[model samples]
Target: MVYTKNKNKNLIGDKVKYARLKNKPKITQNDLLARLAVRGITLEKTAISKIESKTRPVTDKELVAIADALGVSILWLLGRE
Candidate 1:
């Protein structure tokens, strides 16, 4: 299997990449973070960078925001099987 940097090593990079691509028509990482912050969730640019690069884990709550921001299901971001 191809190994990625995500701590889970279970398709996180691909998932994040997919999510990013899905939002391509309008949203962006920085915009997503701004929206999340507006919703009372505080996430830093580096944190998102790490998560996208598969160097960090996406928290449960953050997963929700990510899904929403990307217009996908939380299950998708978590790579649910």
Candidate 2:
């Protein structure tokens, strides 16, 4: 299913961008892409950029993988913790 931006959503992409940037050692988009690749999520750098820029929607599986790769809790990524 195609996903579009929803104003009522919890701004997950923004939260993800913040978590990624705030990570220790400062993770880069390419580094994140590589990490996700290791987790079997093959996303292009542009896709990562778009995700970080809040222009793309992150899937549930991607969210889990990203949180794992970033060493963050899913709750944190979801802004619930």
| lDDT leader | 2
Candidate 2: tens digits of C-alpha lDDT, residues 1-81:
687856433346777678778877888888989999999999976987777667777888998998898888898888888
| Candidate 1 accuracy as lDDT | 0.69
Clashes of each: 0, 0
Structural similarity to truth (TM-score) of each candidate? 0.70, 0.79
TM-score, candidate number 2: 0.79
Instruction: After the best TM-score superposition of candidate 2, give how far the Cα of residue 69 lies from its true spot, in angstroms.
Output: 0.7
Q: Write the per-residue lDDT of candidate 1 for residues 1-81, one digit (tens) a residue.
A: 776553442335567666676664856678778878876779877876677777777667777776776778776766674
List the candidate 1 regions with Cα displacement exceeding 4 Å: 1-11, 24-26
Global CA lDDT computed for model 2 = 0.80
Show the colliding residue pairs in model 2: none
